[model samples]
Target: MRLSSLLFCLCVASFPVMAAGQGLQRSGPMRFLYDMGVSDTDTSDPTMRQQLLQLREAGINVLSLDGWDAAAFQKLLPTLKADPLFSRFKYVLKIHPHVSSNWAANPTQVCSDAANGVLPADTAQLLDGVAAFGKQNADYVVGYYTFDEPSNKGVNNGTTICWQYQQLVYQRLRSGDPDSTDRPVITANTLYPVAPEDIKNSVSPNAQDIVFVDQYSTDPAVQATEYKDWGNMLKKVVPVFPAFSNNITTCQDPMLRTQFRPAVQSGLNTAYGANQPAVAGIAYFAFYPGRTYAYDAQNCAPIFNSVVDDLQHDPIPVMTKIEPSLNLILSCPASSSTAPASSSTSSEPCQ
Candidate 1:
């Protein structure tokens, strides 16, 4: 379980073609976030280790614990800290809001009234908890994200206030933690059939700091364009890490069930989408079957494997190389060109 025994396997054979001299640099490789929220498997189980190893082999670097509460996260920290495979991975810790307030769903809507205080009691408590958790386990914790798809409705109390809340929460989370002050606070955004400009403007500036817009489309051309537009707009201000689906997308075909499952279609879309050149990296969503809470890896393997394969073979145009002296592994991707050499893909494990 020691870090020295770790190895990162890349399946480059599955890729279409590699441009000469274009290699996925050890420090600049795409970072994937894998959701283990609704998954039936738990990190405490024996099978969890194997799962983590396979994900690593497939090029996934971050494991997201979305559904786990703060107490549960604290309990699992030691196990994640000790494991070698985990040592190779970063984590997105999802901390729930304090009691009497459903901030995860809509902090802006719930705390709109003045009596709720300028920042609200639950919001401050949430920040305190996150700061403490982050300070205690700063090594493995890369960033924190709790809200899911907050921009569903146009900018309203639900959406606009959420940004304000995010500003406060992010400020509080990084208050005393000087090391992780620049860490990303990511949230999922809505992607309807409306004009792309509308969707772009709807996203909050705070939310755009670590952009992750999810779009599940049947057409790769459309998906590619969407990725490009979104990437162009968001990349200027923040790093863009979009989510790719594993579900099928042929909505008009006859015998829909008889056709490829959603996951199969998603896998195809992923294959086409990854080659778009605009895509920086992707976070794989295992929840298929109409977004039902389930992690059917058997159904999702095709897309997951395809995206991982693409990342391994295709080296993205390096945005900024890692500078080793900063000692800021979690925040390196968003950091400037002065980053130190990366330890995740390099021989040294990220400290």
Candidate 2:
């Protein structure tokens, strides 16, 4: 093994063994990006394997299976679990029932269906699949990504059903796993601004256990303020995971791209310094190449290569530097039905 790879393994070995359903309880902070963009077709590809190894060495400990449903994950997990390189990182699996659909194509229709309880059976089956998968692969799994940007303007339009949908998913997941101790439900909100009440209403103890807030702006000030604002706003309601923008579409300028590191650093500083709610971890908006918004459906080889290059140069070093100071504050205990008491302290460098 390479020196860095050896070091990473040794470091991972030193951390306490993670118990099922406690969420990611690493010694250092959980550092991950949005999606690996892996599909069933390329699960056995040699080049894709190498790229995953490179990402692990690049300081990302968490791997997100962004768009994969339960069946897709079931088929792919055995192959991934057997691979030494792929098995090294923890995963956040996507379990949303309508993951393959385009929410923007017809928000009203989608929202109406979700509101009217059109997919309860589908949702229950998906949750059961995930719960079974988690029991079988407890070590590799961390949480479930139940929805993405549910209240975005052009997406769910902050509909009451959209918010209720989150509650339904959360309730079902917990009903099966009892407190989601084995695997908590996670959701990501849009980067676009929303009202504070709407944001609060969208999240509840009965809904997502953890919430990822995405804000992409080239300016460090904008990144810092918005991320801190969102963190402060939702920290008490749910554990917050602040996502940084590595997506090139928004960060077109090369110099501005370099500013991402400080932007994330400053955001963490302000959020923790102000004594915000429990910040579970940090995440990048994505690792996929090309524009994330465009949903580029290209070959996996070139896309994986581009992602490897981007990681080797930019976000990896930022994560390497920032990760050390981020200590996991496990003082905030997990609750079965209610939100955990806010136990985050400003004394710790990062939480």
Candidate 3:
């Protein structure tokens, strides 16, 4: 569907807040996740937690970890695991350097044994180590991202990397005691011309996993093309699996300059993230700076907390104000989960 079509349905989203996401899942609203990786090391910062607390109270339940070491990560875990703000919110952590080799359980552990290599570089061993660590933190773990942006030209290898990472977490997930009611999710970043192997060879999206596609396009037309050619087409092959995604965070360095904000603020991204004919959601570039502007969700400003009120104070308003006209969107239900099933809630947020 074209952006024009989305413009039409935009009115329905603005309807009175009723429970939505019946066929989709969850209803309160899709996540306005501000990437929370910056606070991974700075455990002493009361301000970040305050922002997160604001987010939690506001109904945003998902928090994606941007970049950080497994060790420095530990200092922050207690708060995330215990704090009501983050305790129940979904947490996605990206292992630094390389998703596989770098994020081990030990704080002292580094994925790279040599500056040139990341640990054994053995795909199996690397997957195993990463899986074991994720299992320990499985309670809060929403998914494991193997690589930030893989440089693979071959679709098969591109897909192989995808499956290899899945196997790591899956095996550990089966072996570990469950804490969350959700299934394990894995993601790999691939750019356009995603080879057939990459597309065809990866894990089955139907197997209750997300076929996450991370892109960094800034052009609205290009973003629309991504929805049509990349996201829309992939859904035909794997409908349920290609449901969640993000723009790889659009940004420059740390914080967005006033210039980039106009593009992000434009309805393009809001539309693309909401623009699916079937089932899926889009997360913006990122929350803070220091990474790439391409990852920032709210590109208009660099300091995320000040503007996070959009997600925290008035998420529904933000969703209704700026969004694609699509019908299906996923969110957790009103009832608390006992199964750790990764369930898509049909009810709106806690309210």
Candidate 4:
């Protein structure tokens, strides 16, 4: 769709109240990491429980249940509510109409149908399910992740299909629960080198609530520049989460190969700019061993153990030390004299 037309759609749509710094303000400063490397249904497994404890001790406050849908999360919610270890951390839950990894080969059918003026029955049902799930679990569910790394390859005529698809998803989700201010729709896009305009066009308040920029470059300069650029570009449009790499292979310093200290530092520096926290929070790419390209082999028990051990001894401690400062910056309202111009309508400080 033409940029102007897309924006027109956004301007006309009836949206829910999106508080400033939505999730960050509501939940406090979040230290997010992805993938539990266990089945969502295995909430009671002794091994999973131990891992959950380890993550909590490591100062990770938010977990992403990426590959799970509303049904799977609903099934696991009981355990999350009952178990103190599980309940300690807030969660980012996934919903359906997901964009496929191999987008070129297998285009998202729903987006295509959407462009053709069709709302497939199954797709509507899935969105309804997500709305119901978000409403029921708002206490622990901080955000609803609907798309990951959507690209422009799936374009119809002049419009990006995924863009239209995301807008539809957002509308359906909001229509289901207009009063909700939490559980904003989220999308995790691929790393930088992508134009800020394109990023804004694809993921913005019009389509999704927040965009998690996944940047895993090992070079500190690249990390710093890309994150700073993202902060500058999206700060006025939508809140962003810097999803930095926690995989050891991406660590530049030999001394910190087993720690994510540098990654954490860079993310915080950019997100917590001198004037205000530009981004919402810092998110680690993957906590599970095989989730990243650096460690692609699945079911490697030894590697998993090594990763858990590294978290316990290294980066977690570093994060724990500075968490208080992080929360202060994240939760405190920006000074009236120093506050940057924001698109958010609410003037209330982030709690």
Candidate 5:
């Protein structure tokens, strides 16, 4: 744990990581990630385990642990960390204050100090947890999910609050690391409901480090239109951080063959064209095995597993190609959603 400038250059990944000097191109594979239920595979059941192993067999390498008992991680960590192929699997820890609830659980319910225009101590604890976990499991940990789509009602300077809180936790992460452990990456998959202005003014692309967005438009044509719109509006930071866009919950509206083909093709095209710092990948939301976040797959959306299967195949290799260099550039982005400029500062790895 040397506390100096550290730049790791990995040479063998399924995808070819773009050189820092090279701008975004139709580079390697996009990262294949599963926004799982903490233990996407069930904690108690081996079926999820089996599916994950199968995914690894198929070349999948990233998993976003949504919500589940954090305790479950202790048990699976060893197995996940042991597999050489899957060992370096990038993980996102979507944490909950009390467990089992997502940020969107109840907007009316108080979230954290940041939600109320103030910094809360609990935010530090959450960041600390992520940092501690990253240190314990270096190869498997990747990003920290600060908050999932926190803008249903719309708030002024929402990104500012988000940045401030993330910075606090990031400070703590570092403080604990007298050894300067690898900082966890931070990103909040903000819903489009929140204005880009909120994120723009709040995040310091370089300070916040890594970032992700959630744009779920089922209409391929409409979605493609929106991606171009985003590319135009966001500048400065995006081209530097990791950006993730998700599909709107499919259960809300079903996609037809016509709708699906264009949506998939155009959406990818638009993202690729955006030319952000690194469009590491794209992800869908409320992903589950048998059902959708709406809790109804057939109601309107495609089954969770089916969609993942399709998206998973194409991106795995692309990501593999870029893995070598990407693994290092994204190394220490303050996670827990902090922006590294604040009174609420600590050294906990925020990502």
Candidate 6:
């Protein structure tokens, strides 16, 4: 076996096993998902498998793909299933109607169906096709992400519509396949200010299995608050996965690679790893090198290693010690469930 693979196995075997009351348990339980765009049909990319191997070694158990469709997943599954190491890692397939349309189609912009108040005609068809795909690949498939950030404008508009739409798709998948590995519905909402309760309740634990909150802010203070608040809210309802970003709008932003970058990563590992019973794990934003950002996988090596180190060394005690100060500096008034939805809008995806 490769040195990286051997080390990764050793690190995973060393993780502190927890009891039932500590957190919700699931198959192949892992806390970090590296969210990026990867195709199953890249026959020419010889280095693709190596990059994925390195990622798994660095403690990322989930591969959350952004621009992947049902057809791409269908083509890719066999490749992953054939490899023992790759097959061990989980997958989050982003579903859309057409492969080309998914390149820019934001889940928030999906219009609601007039009759049933759910996704529009095109999106509904997309969900059905995606669910059928999930049924065909139940063992290795983890979940499906239909929407990016519904709390923002262009999606649910702070209303419960997005959650309702999630239910429509989630229920269909579950009812379609009653097997244990068939439950897979995932959504990642922006955790700026706070995630609205209306949207949160729309897909309760009974409706959806996992929820992710993104923290793209450069300010560590904001990152801490987002993690704590959103983590607490979604703890019991579903396993919370905090999302991180390697590069903002510009990949060369000095702040991103310098002060702000370390702070953001540290804050994520600390707040999410704090003895919180709800936080299942954390996920990073776009890992696509030339596609999503100029930053390559090498740029993320330190961050990935740090995450593995934190998990291996045991961050609970350290996080517990720093919790009080973080709460003090980042504290805010209780979020009002009735607060007005922000007018800020974005037609683009939240990657």
Compute each candidate's TM-score over C-alphas: 0.58, 0.60, 0.47, 0.57, 0.54, 0.56
| Residues 1-351 of candidate 6: C-alpha lDDT, one tens digit per residue | 000000111112112323323432221233444433445235235344454444443344555443344666777777766655455555666652242143135544542442265545565556566677766765555566555554554444334344555556566556555542334455555545444564464434443555555556666677667656655445322222222234533223232234544555456556666454333344433432243221133454344333334333222211111123111211112222211111122211111
Residues 72-122, candidate 2: write the lDDT tens digits: 777776766676555555566765535314333454665566567554455
Evaluate model 4: give its TM-score. 0.57
lDDT of 5 by residue, 1-351 (tens): 001011111113222433222332332233334345434444334434444443333233466554333455566666655544334456655553322132224323423544454434444555566566756755555544443333323432222234444444445555543222123344443434446665543443322334444444555565555455445433211111111113433232223222443454465455545354344433433432334221122332233333334333333321222334223222222122212111132212213
Output the worst ten-in-a-row residue range by lDDT, candidate 6: 1-10
Give the Cα lDDT of each candidate: 0.41, 0.45, 0.36, 0.45, 0.38, 0.42
For model 3, how does the per-residue alpha-carbon lDDT over 1-351 read when each residue is reduced to its tens digit? 100000001112222222212222222233434344434335344544444444344344455554344554455667656554444454555542444333333212331232223333344444454455556665555454434333244432322334333344444433442322232343444446555566554343432233344434445454445444444333311011111132324432322222222332232334445443332232333432333321223332323432332323223322333222112222212222121212122222242
What lDDT does model 3 reach? 0.36
How far is 133's C-alpha from truth in model 6 (Å)? 3.1
Compared with the true structure, the alpha-carbon lDDT of candidate 6 equals 0.42
The lowest-lDDT stretch of 10 consecutive residues in candidate 5 is 1-10
Steric clashes per prediction: 12, 2, 32, 1, 42, 2
Per-residue lDDT tens digits for candidate 1, residues 113-231, read 32243566656666677656766765556566644444454433334234445455556666645443224555555445435554544444543334444554545455445544444
Best by TM-score: 2
Candidates by lDDT, descending order = 2, 4, 6, 1, 5, 3
Error of 1 at 316 (Å): 8.4
Regions more than 4 Å wrong, model 2: 1-28, 66-69, 97-119, 157-161, 179-182, 195-201, 218-220, 224-233, 236-258, 268-272, 287-351
List the pairs of residues colliding in candidate 6.
108-154, 108-155
Q: Model 6 residue 92 lDDT? A: 61
Candidate 5: segments with Cα more than 4 A from true spot:
1-32, 39-41, 44-47, 65-76, 79-90, 96-119, 154-162, 170-184, 195-207, 218-274, 286-315, 318-351
- Itemize residue pairs with steric clashes in candidate 4: 1-159
